[model samples]
Target chain A: MDLPSRIVITEEGPREGFQIEPGPITTADKIALIDALSVTGLSQIQVASFVNPKHVPGWADAELVVAGFAPRVGVSYTALWFNDSGLQRALAFRGKLTLAGFISLSASEPFALRNLNRDRAGQIEAMQNYARLHWQAGVPIAKIIVMAAFGCNFGGDVPAAKVVETVSDGLSIAREAGIEVREVSLADSMGWATPRRVAAAVGAVRDRWEDLRIALHLHDTRGQGIACAYEGLRLGVTAFDAAVAGLGGCPFAGQPGAPGNIATEELALLCEEMGIATGLDIEALIEAGRLAERIVGRRLPSAALRSGTLASLRRKVGP
Target chain B: MDLPSRIVITEEGPREGFQIEPGPITTADKIALIDALSVTGLSQIQVASFVNPKHVPGWADAELVVAGFAPRVGVSYTALWFNDSGLQRALAFRGKLTLAGFISLSASEPFALRNLNRDRAGQIEAMQNYARLHWQAGVPIAKIIVMAAFGCNFGGDVPAAKVVETVSDGLSIAREAGIEVREVSLADSMGWATPRRVAAAVGAVRDRWEDLRIALHLHDTRGQGIACAYEGLRLGVTAFDAAVAGLGGCPFAGQPGAPGNIATEELALLCEEMGIATGLDIEALIEAGRLAERIVGRRLPSAALRSGTLASLRRKVGP
Candidate 1:
């Protein structure tokens, strides 16, 4: 296996999980979860999503969560937003939150239609507006995130060509706004990705733009997230986004269709066990997962949270 | 990927789930689960374990369950046993079950000592008697199962050399009884397997015995089972053992150390979606997974059961 020696993981559990959970998960609980995650040696932690409170009541306290959490040294905190309003809300905490821009696009047209209620042209027009606003705010466009890059819940199978096409759309938007994007995150938003899809999408994107770095934001919707992540490691793609205890996806069958992202501790286990460094404290991450589960008032989907890190087991076996 | 054109899956949910669940789950529920599984186009199903009732009260009604279910014509039903008494009980249902024998050993000696309370010499001696008894009873020993083949909770990381050595022990016992073993099942009983370990172990064993058919029994303990299975597929392995709704493992972290095996439908999805034939009806198998979850009266860990197959979504996209 030609695996990268060290990889960077972007913790998206706080943003992804709290947004979907039905609970009015308290601002304090959200803050606590973020604070717990901050000490786990993660470099990037997306603490909350700045969105319309009416649409996402769960994240209505996004500002409170952002202000309450005690950010750790060397940890870069970030948040999610889709438009100028959300970006302005994020701008309130300039230094506390590291601000960056993203040109987000859906790889599947049907997904774009169903999710954002926009056609190709309308979607491009909207993103052009989004990129310009961020540039006006002096937030450098960090990367292009291609949602449904592998497959979609509404739009059956997404071929490799479609992913490449989708990336082109984001790049076009960035170009129109005079923004330079250096990375791409192929996201499996609905869990339609198999390892083959991950390989094809990553391969196709890289073939088109050799110098662009690739990251994976995988969902364990169909239980293949870890495998997809494994394939990413084999391809020497190092950046990843995971949820602690698999927060942010659907909790079970018959929910909202999309399930959890791959668990942070589990991914760390996969990487560290294979001699690849994730620079995470598996024990602390598992603790954070349990804390997230408790605050959500339900079990989360992470198997690692239940079985825990092998460190304790290894101790039992001795050196 | 040198993927297989087709693969065979052995369904072990009925036996694996019931044994661990803290339930006096009625014989009817067990029988119903087995019957439901029979229609999912699976060729093999392990229905029950004829163990001492006092030890595994879950399978105490094994006799009743064995007699109760209506088996499908094309499906082969099997059962598990360790001693002469359990074998005799299984023998009583000879016509109902397709009986086969196995030489089961743990690759980790510490695991053997901890799980079975037996040392290496003690385990081999016990297996020798067991194999001789099975041979006399006319039950062909089908395979040698190396448990904790990749890693173990009790023994930490199990080297590939140790796995080869453990398989050698099983073969030695088989040779003593003049029983020819043509297959080997590398089992990650405690969910300690990673893709690299899977590759090393499979490679080592195949190097020693070129003609032996290799099968994988994986656990999703640290959420690496599917990825390991993907690696197995890359190595051209064509046989696997899985649980419906990811049965027969630990449910949560503070529980037993081991968790579920790879979910059956998810494995089927991995194969079928990749254009590999699994001879499984993905929908029917999902329905079966739901039934297993209902019988167990808890949420299972299968993401496919929740998100469902892409067939429904495909219908939305015109051919």
Candidate 2:
């Protein structure tokens, strides 16, 4: 099958990867890492999440991290926000950062309640209000994320139709605020997605909304993350969410040891061999992974880090 | 994007997984593991490899291991042979076992010499002689394996043309021995293959040898093993080689810590989600993975084992 020649890799290692760690990472270290990633040719990097300090203490220094970002010419430093309080903080940095709005739908009612403290209907209502508030503050929402789009921790197989319906509901809110919904991301938050499910969901979204740009935010919890990304590429998804050093996991995922997102360098390895133009320097990405490992003080779960790339291996053993 | 509805999974964990460990596992442990895998509905299990005992001390008791297998009715218990001496040992167990012949082509001359004590031409000649001897001894040779088909540890970016030429030479040898070549396997021994390389090579093989039953033996060294398998399935390969508990690696691949073949349970997860029938019991395969971890005394590189499957996760967090 013909695949797109270029794909966008949105780095989440600094933000998502850092948040789930047990203790705090220094603001200086976070800034240094983001600055290092800036020169790695990524089009976008999720620098921090404007979350409640009590809920996510590791990112309590979000303001400091954001202020310290020495922006590269072409890279957009982005931040994620979950509620009104987070959105207010994101809006405070209006010109310096791109605000990322999130809306997660749990396929299982129990998961919805446990993770978000709201059922699907209540979550949708809350999201509609958030969209309106963002619009009032002059922040136009272009995309919304749908978490657990494949399957859920509390439910085995989530229906694709439910995910599409949830996206439609989010899009309706965007329409109410007079904002064009340009993108929708399907997140395997629990890493419950397989290639077939990814293809089916992406295909369903494409069929329903023709012009909308689709992206995938996959977790390696089930080992099928890379496969799902590959399937997404075949189905024409041009953007993906990944972490450096394979850091990050859902705190409410019930399993604390579940793997993080697909490692950025691992994804780049696939793109590099496929001749897909990711515009990433593999060496720099490797360095970023090393920095992540140092920041976390653990061996991160990156395959490329564990086993060096084919070229690097040859260099070591070359005649 | 039409795909085949079913695929074949060849289990190699018992032989490949066990052989690489530093110490010896009892003959009884090997037998028990193979017997457990037999019930998991695999069509083929590579039970042992007859190599130099000094080189692979793990399989030194190959004769005892082969004699003890209580055969499953439908499953073919197979053994791998490296040379004339190994072939002689395999012929002794002819009635009870299916012999698996292997010949690896290293893209780098140094790798070929260090691993096989042969250059490209010499390895081809040796493979031809082996094919003739096997045929003379009444064992029909129809399949040959080409390792480092993607890239090599000592040489990066192995030419696809070289792989095709190597396979062609092996087929010629089989034909010379009056054996109709029916199967040829491409092995990413160093785990360096990507989806596009897999597609390109499979497309080339399909274009040339239209009716050949192609197989892939992939390693997860670079973390693209599962993705490569998915691509191969899209391109119409029905057979795959996986190890139980994600075991097996090239002893000469420069990095001893590199990952082995794709985990069978992990592959089953993909197959189950894709709706491709592999006739394997996933729960049984997972149990087999746990057993492998116990035998190897380390956590095998299987995502399914670390993070339970969707079904198991749901069970844990379900209402």
Candidate 3:
């Protein structure tokens, strides 16, 4: 249970957070917020999702957002894609953005169909197609996100074997298509994972693919995200995905009451307190949360923003 | 970091939760809810706090609530005490309720004075008096809770050395008064503890006091409660205190926006998923959350109650 000395957090507020909002946030606001987050010492940020506007109206201006975004010197900006059309939209960005190709596989066929518009095999095939197209276009597929890796909304008990199998199949397809795979991001889309479950999955994958970099995209829908992240860190999976202010939820989960991704501020505080070097300016992160609250016109569920950081708390309550 | 086979979870909704609430929840409603929780495989519940009604008006009817409470066999009900008068009130219950004595302390003098109306030394002296009185009366003090064990709202950075020193001083006083100490519960009163901090404090205490049982009373204000609990578990500390539906916040923290205790239902789900036996009926616990929401006339912050537990999730998303 030895933890890593450092972890990489990827901010996903602009895309995931904004997509679940009731109304569209102005492109200017998105650009401004993303720009603000770019300097927060995060290694990467998921700026926007290149999905169909008909499906998610809030992200309709993805192109404009990506175009207007000004990346910080050391931080890489990425976007998400679901299918060929989404990939095409991302490819249109050419070398401007690092495209994070997504393949959501649920051991449950119904969930796989409803969420990914394909069964497990079909989804793997689509990923192969996705890899082939990127290869044909001479573009690199930076990462393939295995969504619902823990458990799915329609699929019960996504076994560790299934997750490993899915990742292996996706990677095998990429190898056949001659596309070099960068990493695999295991997402707890339903927020159904616990620490032990995370340990088992991450351990199994890490043991099998020793050299592959593993990342976690966890949600706090069931209040287990932070604990899961701690377990992931113990397992030495460094990259994590979080949203500012706990801002996003799965629009497809049919549960509006579900919580968003783990708050970046909270995660930063955890990392800092654990002696893990996140290099995040928590003051800047809290300010970003405040800005998000102002833009969303409501209170967010981020605890660190409301409670203040550990150092601030210590100073505030000091003698 | 081997986890225990099982952990003890103490439900504190009626006592801690009702105390912070604005309106009066009738004795009948309180009795009904406690009775319902009694059958949910919970070993213990803090039914009421014998504090002055003038301070926490919601728990004004502590005597009446205790009188009306119907405890099931094998379930131990306890009441919290601040001073001798509260102890006298708890003593009236005689064999019916286990008395839990509380002494609020802070390394910060301002916090100790403002919160407890006494400095740390004075608070320890009062605990000694409480122990002598309880022993002379032939009544056992089931547990002593060290409030603000991590950090205080007014006292910043409660060092591990300070926590150990406080506990040692309190224990020394009890021994001098010829009282036996059964357990020590650490309260993260303002919910500022991170996992490593919890590890440090719990590890220090466990190393120093190996035979004494350790428990954690955690709040989720900064969204690190479950992870702290995990760290405590890893350190071989088993017992945890949680409100049924994330129900209680510190009225003394000055910021009402701070969150409540970690939800019992959520914690149960974590333990169940981790193969750590809690013996809690999560379905019934979630029902308790619903009932709590009904009594409070608002939705609680418990994520498991909102999104459903792992079993329920698997069932709902099953073939």
Candidate 3, residue A233: Cα displacement in angstroms equals 1.0
lDDT for position A53 in model 1: 92
**TM-scores of the candidates in the order shown:** 0.97, 0.93, 0.94
Each model's DockQ? 0.70, 0.58, 0.71
Q: Which has the better TM-score: candidate 1, or candidate 2?
A: 1
Candidate 2 chain A weakest lDDT stretch, 10 residues: A100-109
**Which one is best on DockQ?**
3
Instruction: Say which candidate scores most in TM-score.
Output: 1
| Chain B vs. true chain B: TM-score per candidate | 0.97, 0.95, 0.95
TM-score for predicted model 3 compared with the true structure:
0.94
Ranking by TM-score: 1, 3, 2
Model 3 clashing residue pairs (backbone): A317-B156
Residue B173 shift from truth in candidate 2, angstroms = 1.1
Q: What does candidate 2's lDDT look like per residue over A185-288, in tens digits?
A: 88887888888899788888888999889889999887899999999888878999999868888776866766799989999888887878899988788888
Q: Could you tell which candidate, 1 or 3, scores higher by TM-score? A: 1
Off by over 4 Å in 3: A100-110, A317-319, B100-110, B317-319
Q: Give lDDT per model, in order.
A: 0.88, 0.82, 0.82
